[model samples]
Target chain A: MFEHTENINNEEYIPETYIPTAVSHGTKELWQVFWILLGITVVDFIIYFAMGASMTRNIIFILMGLVKAFFIVGTFMHLKFERQFMILMIVLPALAFIGMLVFGLLHEGNALSIDY
Target chain B: MSTHTTVTNTTPTWAGGRSPFNVSYGKLMMWIFLLSDAFTFSSLLVGYGAIRFSYSGHPVTPWPDPALVFNHFPGFHGVHLPLLFVSLMTLILIISSVTMVLAVEAGHRKDNKSVLKYMLITIIFGSMFLGCQAWEWSQFIGEGARLNENLFGFTTEAAAKAGNLKLFDHVHWDMAADRTPGPVPFASLFFIVTGFHGFHVFSGIVILVVVYINALFGTYERRGHYEMIEKVGLYWHFVDLVWVFVFTFYYLI
Candidate 1:
C-alpha cells in the first residue's frame, strides 16, 4: 500500500501553516440567508411603528435580532458547515456568558430603579 | 512509522496530524477573535441596559425616548422620521455583507476577477454605511447630545407634542424651550456603543481594501488558496451582526 503517513515527516509538512483546500458551496444558500435577514429587518421596522414601546415589543425585536444573528453567523460566517466540536466550542460559552450577563445585570438594574 | 501507516486509513480526528475542526489555522484564530469581540460588545450592551434601567423613575432627568432624539433624516430637517436613516444604514451593511460573502465565494472558485469586483462593491457599501453613521453622529452632537450630558429631556408639553408626531411630520424643535438636562449616560452610552461599532465597520473596510489590493496583485492565486478572503469575510459579517443588535436595542427598543 502507498505510505501516506510518510508525507508528515517530509520537509514540506509544516503544521503551523497547513491550510485545507476550500470548496465552493455555491451562493444559493447565502442568498437565501440574505433574504431572510432583510425580511426580518423589514418586519422589525414595520412593527416599531405598528406597536407602542412595551416589553412584548422589545422582546419581539430582540428575538428577531437573534434570528438575524443566526443567519449571519451560521451561513455568512460558514459556522454551520464547520465541525460540531468547533461549533460547540464557540457557541456554548458565548450563550452562557451572555445569558448570565443579561439576566443578572438587568435584575440588578431593576433593583436599583426600585431604590431610586 | 509502521503504526502510523496502520492508522492512516482510519485516522482519528484528534490524532494530531490534522485540524480537528477542518479549518485553516488562520480561520480558527479568526473565529476565536470574533468570539472575544462578541463578548466585549455584549458587555457594553448589558451595561447600557443596566444604566438605562437604573434611571427608570428619575423625576428630573428621565431616560430619553429614542424616537424624539433619533427622528431626523437628511434633507428632511425638522421632520419626525424615526428609524429611517438607521434602517438605510442597516440595509447598506447587510448588502455589503452579501457582497463580501460573494467575494469569498468567488475566491473559492479561484475567480480572481469576480472576487475583485465583489470586493470593490463591498468596500463601497461599507463606506456608505460609515458615512451614514457619521451623519447620524453629527446630527446627535449638533442637537446637544454631549457625552457628559443629554439635552433630550422634553417638557410635559413637548412630550405631549412628541406623542402625536407621525413619520415625516415637520415640527420645529426649540431646544431651549422643549428640553432640559436628561440622563447623562444615555448620550455617553450611545456614543460609546455605536462608536465602537462604527469603528469596527471602518476597520473592516480598511481590511477589505488591503485584501482587494492583494487580490489585484494575484497574491492568493499565487498561494493556491483564497482562505484570506474567508477570514476577512468573517470579520465583515461580524460587523453586520453587531449592527443588528445595535439597531434593535438602541433604536427599536
Candidate 2:
C-alpha cells in the first residue's frame, strides 16, 4: 500500500505547477457523448412529431430515453470509469427500485381503470 | 507467546486507506446521495403516473393535454409550437451537462482556467434553463392552469353546445371529461413533479456558481484535484437525466 505520509514527503511526487488541459482525450470523449445524446434527443423529437401516438411508438420513445440515459450516466457521471462493483452497486439497486415503482404503479393504474 | 505469531486485524476499520472502490470518498458519497435522490424522483413520477392514469375510470374527467397547454413560445403569441420550447429547454440542459463534463475533464488535467471557463458556461446554461422554466410556469398560470382545480371546461362538445358553460369550451379548454377531480390530479401532479425538478435545477445552478467562484479563487487548484467539479458534474448530469423523463411523461406522452 502507498503511504500518503511518505508520498507527501517525496519531492519527486509533488508537481510544483499544475496546468489543466484545454483540450484532452477526456474533453474529446465528452464531446462525442454530447453529440450522441443530442442525436438521440433529436431523433426522439422527430419521432414524437412525425408519428401518431401508439403503444409501439411510446415504447420506442422510452427505449431511446433509456439509451440516452445510459450514455449520460456512463459518461457524464463517469460511472464507466469506476469499478464494476461500484457501478453495479449503485445502478442495479436503483434500477430494481424504479422497476418496482413502474410495475406497481401500472398495477395500480389498471386497478383504477374504469374499464376494469 | 506462541511459536507462530497469529495476525489479528492489522488495520483499524476507521483507518484511512486507498479507496476500495478506486474513487474518492466524496465522489462515492455523492453518487450514493444521487441514487437516493433518484429514488425520490422516481417515486414522485410513479405516483404522478398512477394518479394521472387512474383517472381513466372517470368518463367526463378533464386532463389538459400537455401538447396544447405547452404550445406557446416566447414572442410567438397565438402561434402554437408543440414541444419546441420544452425541447429547447432540454437541449439547453444537455448542453449545460456537456459543459459540466468538460469542466470535470479540465479538472482532471489540473486546468484551472478551463475548469473556470467550463464551469461558468455550465452555470449560465443552468440559469437559462431555470429562467425558461419560470416562463413556462407563468404561461401555465396565465393560461389558467391550476394545481387544485380545472379552470377549463369538461367536454368541448358540451361546452360548445351549452353557451353558458365557461370552463370547457373549444375556444378555451380541449376535449377532456371535466368531472369529480377533473384536472386537479393533472394540475397538482404537474406542479409537484415539475416544481420539484425546478427546485433541483435551481440548486444545481447555485452549486455550480459556488464551484465556479471556488475555481476562480484557486480553491481546487490548491487542493491539487478537481474532484469538486466531478461531484457537482454528477449532480448536474442527474438533473438533466431527470428532465429527460419529465419531458417524456409530462409533455410527449
DockQ of each: 0.47, 0.30
What are the per-residue Cα lDDT tens digits for candidate 2 across B64-88? 5566567768877756577889999
lDDT of each: 0.89, 0.76
Residue B231 displacement in candidate 1 (angstroms): 0.5
C-alpha TM-scores of all predictions:
0.93, 0.83
Clash totals for all candidate models: 0, 11
Q: Write the per-residue lDDT of candidate 2 for residues A13-108, one digit (tens) a residue.
A: 112232222224557788899999999889988997788768788788888888989999998888887666688889899989999989888666
Specify the poorest-scoring 10-residue window by lDDT in model 1 chain B: B1-10
Best by lDDT: 1
After superposition, which runs of candidate 2 have C-alpha atoms over 4 Å from their true positions? A1-25, A114-116, B1-17, B152-154, B158-181
In terms of TM-score, the best-performing candidate is 1
Candidate 2's C-alpha lDDT? 0.76
Give the Å error, residue A17, model 2: 21
Candidate 1 lDDT, tens digit per residue, B1-253?
3443323435566766666776778898999999999999999999898888888878878889898889878998798899988999999999999999999999999999999999999999999999999999999999898889788888888889988988878888788898888888999999999999999998999999999999999999999999999999999999999999999999999
